[model samples]
Target: MALPSFFVTAGRRWLKLALALGGAAIAQTIPAHAAQPAAPATIRLDYLHTGNATVEQYAVERVVIEPLPWPGNMARTVDDTDRGVNLVEVVDKASGKLLYSRGFSTVFNEWRTTPEAEKTNRGFEESVRFPKPEHAVTVRILKRDENNAFTLAWSTELDPDAPDVLRKQEPSALRPIPIRVSGPSPDKVDLLILGDGYTAGEMKKFEATARRMADQLFAVSPFRERAKDFNVWALAAPTPASGVSRPSTGVHHASRLGTRYDIFGSERYVLATDNRALRELAQNAPYEFIEILVNNDTYGGGGIFGQFSTAAANSDWAKYLFIHEFGHHFAGLADEYYTSPAVYQPSGTRIEPWEPNATALRDPANLKWKKFVAPGTALPTAWPKAEFEAYSRDIQQQRVALRKQQRPESEMSALFKRELAHEEELFSRAPERRTVGAFEGANYEAKGYYRPQMQCLMFDRSEQFCTVCQDAISTIIDLYSRPAQR
Candidate 1:
């Protein structure tokens, strides 16, 4: 074994030859990220958005440099698809030039519509993230005025290199599992499917559900067609139990993300109010969008535009909730259903809604989706509203009673199946079922507001999005799937 001097010399000569080649062979010595230019660090401005129905205010909490680089598409720095109630603009402090802007609705905005906000003062911790600039920058948050114009709500200046900015953080042992990776984080839509109530023993079940839901998401049109434009990742921090809190039925468990059912006294509403806890865990993954997976079979989910969405991963209609709630979070689309009870009290005035799918129809001739209208189609489209409302109203009554009685989840699922079957049968016979005409009743209103179609996933448990909703979602898709402009 000690007499192999000739062979050792031959191996050294071969390595020298590879090094002299001066191409991929030489580049192999360096890491891939090192070979490419480093991405800008992700900067998050955490703040308190607090106040009531008549007044609102914002104050800074702290700024943090997230662990991962910005997962957003750098080629398209500006968001052109205007949506949401608020807009965030980042400008160069000294030059006063706009650097980045995005439209997003906060959880506080939704909460403000509820009666609770009218009676009490509450604060919500919200965050706006942007690519870290080299120097100081001004962050401005704008809210819509009564005239529907975006006016400055709050402004603050901060330096990325400031001493107070949090740079170092506790290392996360959590790692993301790739469900479907089409390309690099910046080039594709990076969606993080986070689990909130999975125990260490159920990690594998969480993973399987995540993958299954992700696949079903792609099975829908648009997403199915544009499947290659996305990268899906799943990550879950172990919890002490397997299901999230459901206070209505006296079922409670300690959850890592603070996600729970019965949000705002609505038994079927699920939400996580703790933004910091959610962000801390999500920061470990390269995600531009997050869909929290709650380990429960309850018929509940909630979505806030630009904020994260939650769905009961174990529900019988899990796929429906997964796609529908994501539609709200990803595209800022509003609910098109109205027969169901909502926690939010309606504002006295019926101003035009900002959502792309729903409209006030103040000027029907100039409808937002007028282009899709057939030549002879009515502006205020007529449908079997009376009969449909009669059926839906009865279903709503049954729904409330079932929850009041603390009925089994299987009964709820069966009721949903019946409701869907009735809706399908009812709509299938209508002439304007799939038409692009405006249908009265949407945005939690039986009057004034109108949706683009008679039935859509946004409106009901239908399988497809309405034409207008499809276009609206596609616009957002293009925003994320920015063409290589750089």
Candidate 2:
């Protein structure tokens, strides 16, 4: 019914600043308008997701009552956007009414597509959180079948009042500092920025980096235009070491979050494998979205929709990495570039992807973004594909050689700058540079899949989101916060 008292007790300076900005204070947990009902207690279900490419299984580990109240808008409890590889649905047991539902992708789903999944079975920890219900409910996880339609994969009945449910927990040593407090949590999108691999001496640096990244996120639209619809909170636990593990480089260090580079053996792919450690620390704050900042200067980051996104806080291109990876985590936008090597094996069959950006273009007449297409524009829009691929191939080789040679991070950063310059020059001369039409080479394939534009943040290091991507992101913003006034 109230914000955890530690928020005020542990961060006095931030509390005072929040109050000065007329943001909600700890004592004023509810909105000033008393008519709004208090948010329900937050409930988290921890589970183990295990399997290989051929088979999978899910099992409930435990249910927890998070310290903070639910931060989501009660008015909009069901997700209609239809993104992600899996969906979580909570149904009232007695009446069979759907009380809450959300779509999310997991590390397991990403892993299953890799070659390793074919050889051996492995497991990943996963968690789903919702507002606690008064009575028994059926929690079902639906997975996409071969046809890309949702099919029930696992289900369990849960009772919130059960004696085994964890109703309390020890207070976390880390306390959330209010970075940008727009309003009450339920009325705004609460984004929690977490820091990993920062020592006690570097906590101040971590906060500054988190603040900078949050600012970078809002500098882009529609986040820029709808900035008032969100709140930002930051928290970090001190680590014994200063940087996270980069196994490929033979550098290893322990951190509160088990985040490390060389995920799936890709040098620049960073991710936290320990989901339970992440969830435990995050429960201390009221958050709907999370972005983890790792204390490393390497060019690496990873994101999974509805889980979390990670960015290198000390990279030369940290701002771009932060916003670019956040695009995947925040809106379920697929990667548009294809030249870079990835861990996942190519799919033999092309099914229409559920992500908002890329498409198989199976039905050109009814392209998902047809409304944005110009009247006479070609379905598979023309672009300089041949030339672009030729150039990208050379750049990819240089990128690989730099990492293989153990070159300095600055050299890699310089190469990226040059690559972006070439891309911009190439795109400028193209006839359909600004056109909203299907461009070949997307979703990590040189053919079959198409993106909506010639260049976008998802496609390259460019700063702007494509028109189609902007629309997709706005839809999600509206779902979590109040819709824009007509």
Candidate 3:
């Protein structure tokens, strides 16, 4: 995650400019709008030293910039090619001249807007290192159009020598600690989970939910038996209110359910949503193996490996979303169906997947889980197709009825809650709680889209991942243990 050497040189030039500008005039010219009372922008900078130096003593050698959500209600679209024009400039606090200037583009994937989507949504982080005496730095951003006309969007100052205020303020109970075990330290895999909304108090309420989700994740294949090898850091912070929801006409149409919307665009972040921002955050947590966003609601979540994973914060089914998505985030598991938003364009006609479970062909020779297939077992397990269809229809009808209710105390809540509770109780009675089966209601398809278990936490509102998922989680932990000594 180190910034390239060329970027370090650019930062130096920006600093030189800032030194030449001097501080007095620039300080006085603070925008009148900025002077007026408004919500104080909460900008946090965490300097991480990939080498032996401590973050405080570490001299920033380069600055990687990540822009954050803008402050307004506006529909703006920047393609990856068009985004490269945005520039970040670092200035010497005393001089106001630029110390470094670098340009980066927005993400290539198009993100549609909904009125409920977070407004002025920009999320990026920057890493800059300084030699000589570490000094205070002011960071400014200039976003330009095709004509090169620039508009100032953000400015902030930080002392590289100082410790991170937020880290220190984090409650000890909420901080991540190494998971200990007998023998050598299990390969450590850190999960740094970001938050959208869910204020500190709300986070506390949802902490148990988060921990339970993590526990369920580790309980699945790959992870369950190796619980001591991982660390989880929940970076819970409230997002701007404007970021809660937006109008959308695309895949985000799922947001209409209120139970499926993620105001912060969690999936976008994982898919290298914005290179500049992702790089910055990665630099901050260079050792992180996965980054999940815990949004504050009963909404659905998404995941992608080497990218990001997300889940609802306080939903009754939060545990299910967390571990199910982790299957995608950690093991590169594919959606067991052909539906949902076409976020990933299928290329070529190949069917076998690198994932451990999903398969496109009935032929054992082509499936990834051939080793696990039983002898003489049918290609597709016999399932109660008709019964499942009837059950699904019933559930949908109940969901529609519940959605129409206006109050939390409505009869609809009682009915939905009762059915959900009954399902949970039934799932709990299984002898091999971790075993996988043909679980209904998963991915986006109702037919071939089956999960590994008849009633796993991944496929329903249960509380534990199936054995296969546990194995996958464990495998990921093992993969991260050994260093690639290339």
Candidate 4:
């Protein structure tokens, strides 16, 4: 059977680069013996699949890279400039033939560079797709830099005759268990919200916040125009009771926390929750997207294609968080700013990003969005620092006021139950409303980053969706629902 075209191109490139490098080294090291025949390099490949099909799909979506450490002291230090490994081939372990290969730059600690500092080890990670059952695989790495003449990094072998694991991991095939919210299958989009840190008694509080978020989502594009076409599954898993006794107050001190709370920070937590939620949504309703409702007010959220989740730090800003995060989930929109810490390193100066929207296109002729941009829209939208500073101060004051006002517990419960119309009204009339120019506090940088609209729900504490955001949401919905053209 023929391998994929990408794999073929990658393999050829790897072979060419390896041969050239090896030839150069041999000519220098043993000039007299260079004419003698050299042995062909031996390569091996392997595949390691976690026993869950959903997890396998999630892994591919997240771009998990499994590292293959070089054996022996090939170089003086792991970070040596001249030291590197080239991925030669990805092959089926059951058969010795190559399935895929690529000639790509291998950085020592690429993951820790910028965006990835907080997430992974500062080491090499190659981008490889997750394989299905009977597809046992191995990747071949050639260490050909000045330090190492030749070495095989790692490989895997699998028993193809064994029973398949995918069948058992499929959620629909598993026995059904009772879960929240079942019914008449409206054409409604299913929104899944994962809980972060709400205590046992706080379930209602979280639920109300989630409902408000759902309302905000519907009020915006895609969901807004199609309000009745949606249902929300708010998963309020109580934080384990006996984990570690810490302060009951909302303020969390890092010192006294234990394993349960600590696990929330793990990548595993994010992946597992996402997989389960997506599976359930897929099995149930039309399953539009998944949203995670975070409990803390620290202000962080993430989204991916076919998935949208958000957290409500405080009841007041629930609308803003919901809409802003949906931008990422709905649109493959790149974060406009580069300041905040991220999970993946900014792929350094060499290769351009594959995201449709953002790019460091220094050349105006090659800009990806040049066609859509108005002829006069500046390449870098300039923001006056003085204006931004004033805006920041006003936003800070509003945040302070929102945090200080401790609504009665009953009111808080009502807020969670979606019974409080006053709170929604308050959000609509927020003082941060500005009809013109760029408003700060979006994407990342409070200054350089400006959202496309003036007072969008993504940019401000409002329930209104800006025209640009609305269009984006609509496009995503169409993409998800549209059938492939012949």
Instruction: Go through the candidates in order and give each one's C-alpha lDDT.
Output: 0.84, 0.88, 0.41, 0.38
| TM-scores, each model vs. reference | 0.92, 0.94, 0.50, 0.46
Candidate 2 segments whose C-alpha is farther than 4 A from its true place? 1-34, 484-486
Residues 1-486 of candidate 4: C-alpha lDDT, one tens digit per residue = 233322221222222322232344322333343222111111112222222211111122121211111111111111111112333445677666564343223223222234334543332222322222235555455544333354564444433234432222233332211122222111123455655556678777766776666666666665666554343555544564312211222434221111111122322112122232333333322233556665554333444433344444463545656676666555545454333334443322422333234344445555544544555555444334354345445554544343347434344333333422433444356443333223333444443334443345443344665555555555544432311110
- What order do you get sorting by lDDT, best first? 2, 1, 3, 4
Q: Compare the candidates by lDDT and give the number of the best one.
A: 2
lDDT of 2 by residue, 1-486 (tens): 343221112222323333543345533643344444446778999999999998999999999988777778766788999999999999989989888999999999999999899999999999999988878899999999989899999999999989999998987666788888776666688899999999999999998998899999999998999888888998888999999999987899997889999999799999998898999988877788999999999999999999999999999999888998888999999999999998889999999999999999999999999999999999899999998889889999999999999999999999999999998999899999999999988999999999999999999999999999999999888888855321
How many residue pairs clash in each candidate at the backbone level? Answer: 0, 0, 67, 27
The sequence of per-residue lDDT tens digits that candidate 3 reaches over residues 95-144 is: 66454443332221123122222233322323322221135777655555
lDDT of 2 at 245: 99
The residue-by-residue lDDT of candidate 1 on 68-166, one tens digit each, is 667766666678877989999998888887778999998888888898888998999999998888778999999898877899999999898899999
Query: What residue pairs are clashing in model 2?
Result: none
| Models, CA RMSD each | 9.0, 4.4, 16.6, 18.0
**Candidate 1, position 66, lDDT:** 88
Ranking by TM-score: 2, 1, 3, 4
Residue 135 of model 1, lDDT score: 75
